[model samples]
Target: MRNQLLAVLDIVLSARLVNANVIRIAEEAHKAADPHLALALVSARGTTTNPVEIALDLEMLDAAVDCAKEALAEIEKIKRVVSKNVVELEAAPSLPGGDAAMRRDAIQENLDEIDEGFQICGARLQEMETVRDIADKRRKALVARV
Candidate 1:
């Protein structure tokens, strides 16, 4: 029974860690997918024949694409971590005695949190993908103009 309690505690701690990671990744994704950054990429016109201006625009587009790709990768990591946590929660042993109900409740709460985190990550991933696509298109357009 003592071992079972310890196992439950370990699972809870692991779940908390996963949640923290998810939060961190979401923040990163939010920064990478900033609406202003996307707008800047979309609004930047390579119509000017100035070599310097075109080069600068290309550099900016490249940076945006890199950031978006990194964010997308981070989001994918979060998804995998969350999925693993869900599995752990499911496999956690029920505590003995009156604590059994409490353990079940804690597991359920962790699952709920993981589900919410997954949903949030999904939205962020979509946003990051959109930003990446816009940056790619803008970069191509700029390159073509050059």
Candidate 2:
């Protein structure tokens, strides 16, 4: 579980640096285009750059990932727990049409639920990745004095 926690924890923890970089760069980019936006970014960057806030945001992100992972773990545990009963129910020797079909339906439903959650998480992660990549390139350009 601890190892699983660490693995799943990355969804939030590592993403923070990505998100921070994104907001910082995007804000700078938006601001660079205009005086008013730059002014707004200046205010936002200050709050964002604060050490306390940075740490808090990072922890919050990690916790969100952890919660998601915890829920996933629970589902997996549930699948395992019910699997035996599922097999027995579906495999009953006297049952008509077979218990396997019944088990299949249950498993399919559980899988569908898992797939839905995973898709949402995947979309969010992809957005973060897109933002981070843009931010990195922008920073590199600025550093190059471009």
Candidate 3:
């Protein structure tokens, strides 16, 4: 019975870890999606005719996009683990200490957090992609002019 309880605890901890990671990634993605970044890109395009300056600006935008892509990949991996953890949590036997309800509640809370993290990350990624597209267009125009 102790072993069963420990197993459930382990699963809960694992799920919590994944949820934390998701939240961290979402936060990073939010930074990448900052309006200031988009505004800077636009300002660079409108105010700078120098190819070198434009190139540098585009590079910064590209880096943000790359960071967002990496975060997205990490989120996908975390999602798979979260799914497995949810299954394990559901199948966990009742704890010996009569804390099964507590465990269930924790699992549900973690799941909710993970879901919210995914939504936030998704929106941020979309915003980052839109910024990247604008940078791409500017870069192409610069290339054509040179």
Candidate 4:
């Protein structure tokens, strides 16, 4: 699940970043070019497709950010549950080579795995946020230009 979320997030972030950059360049072109040329560039040879593409990118970025946040929250919850179990396991006495000892080891292993997962999700969320911020800023700048 963690791997899947990370993969999805990576794809979304990459696409959003690229699209945002393209929109920014187009906006810049519009600002710097003459009236007729600006219109041609922004409308893509009079097709008026830039607005629709930008709108779609904005919508997808918003949805992806929301999904990443939810995934991070779910990871946090899992980490908390696993941490509590590990603590409880530690509080109990374990006989050498006994079942309790085995259980404790297993729980410890699970806790470690959860910790790794949390770290991965946290990093991915941070990266996604950075991309989202850049895209948003570019969008706002373009809007202001208009």
Candidate 5:
């Protein structure tokens, strides 16, 4: 239970970091583009797109990857704990008949729960990887243009 709470806190902190990075990226976008040129483009045409925005968006993607890394760390920690618990339970000697059965049941329940959590975390990590791949492609395109 305490570990779950800590994981939640870690996720929240990571999310906050992502948000801050997004704001920084937006600020950078403005700095990278010439305001006069942007204004002229806006005036002449209905819409103006800055290449800098794509570069900044790539930075934002990196930030998101960082956040996902943090979450992955927490998930790894949880997995380690689960492994340790399983080892301890396995090493422990079985008590009298009924007591042994109860202990086994409890251990199995805990292991099941941990396994479920692990699967969820693993899926999310995979999703983050996909996003990172897309970000890499975007970065390459932006770099080629610049």
Candidate 6:
């Protein structure tokens, strides 16, 4: 369980770092190009560039940032839940609140939840790759033109 938790943690952190970098790049684009002004200029041109294409990339990058933020929150919650469980697991059970069977069941349940969270986080990180691809393509197109 600990190993699996670590794997999930690593995945979440990596994705978050990547997305955060993407956001920074977007910020730089906004600064360097005045993306809003560029969008307006493209709109004024009327037929040269498709505004929808730029809009889609912007929207997806926004969603990706939000998803990364959510993943971070889930990672924190998982850490706290597991930490609490570890503490409880280490305590010596006294006169009848928790028997061996109860403890075993609790441990198993926690493990299962952790694994499920692992799957969810893993899937989110995989989706982030798609987001990165979209962003990279859009960014490269901009660079090519400049």
**TM-scores for candidates 1 onward, in order:** 0.58, 0.40, 0.76, 0.56, 0.48, 0.45
Q: Which stretches of candidate 2 lie over 4 Å from their true place?
A: 1-47, 97-107, 115-146
Candidate with best lDDT:
3
RMSD of 6: 12.6
Model 1 C-alpha lDDT per residue in residues 1-146, reported as the tens digit of each score: 78767766776676677667766766775665565455544445334444455455445545655665675566566556656655665566555475645655665675566567557656655654555455456656656786
Q: Write down the worst ten-residue block by lDDT for model 5.
A: 39-48
lDDT at 36 for candidate 3? 43
Q: Per-prediction RMSD in angstroms? A: 4.5, 15.4, 2.9, 15.9, 12.7, 12.6
Task: Give lDDT: candidate 5, residue 64.
Answer: 53
Winner on lDDT (2 vs 6)? 6
Candidate 4: worst-modelled 10 consecutive residues by lDDT: 32-41
Clash pairs for candidate 6: none
Candidate 4 runs further than 4 Å off? 1-52
TM-score for candidate 5, residues paired by index: 0.48
Q: TM-score rank, highest first?
A: 3, 1, 4, 5, 6, 2
TM-score of 3: 0.76
Candidate 6 Cα errors over 4 Å, as ranges: 1-52, 94-100, 142-146
Top of the candidates by TM-score:
3
Q: Which one wins by TM-score: 1 or 2?
A: 1
Error of 3 at 29 (Å): 3.8
Clashes of each: 0, 1, 0, 0, 0, 0
User: Over all chains combined, what TM-score does candidate 2 have?
Assistant: 0.40
The residue-by-residue lDDT of candidate 5 on 1-146, one tens digit each, is 45544543443344344434434443443343334233333323323244455445545545555555555465456546555554554555544355434544554555465456546545654654565455455546556776
| lDDT (Cα) of model 5 | 0.48
Model 1 lDDT, residue 110, Cα: 57
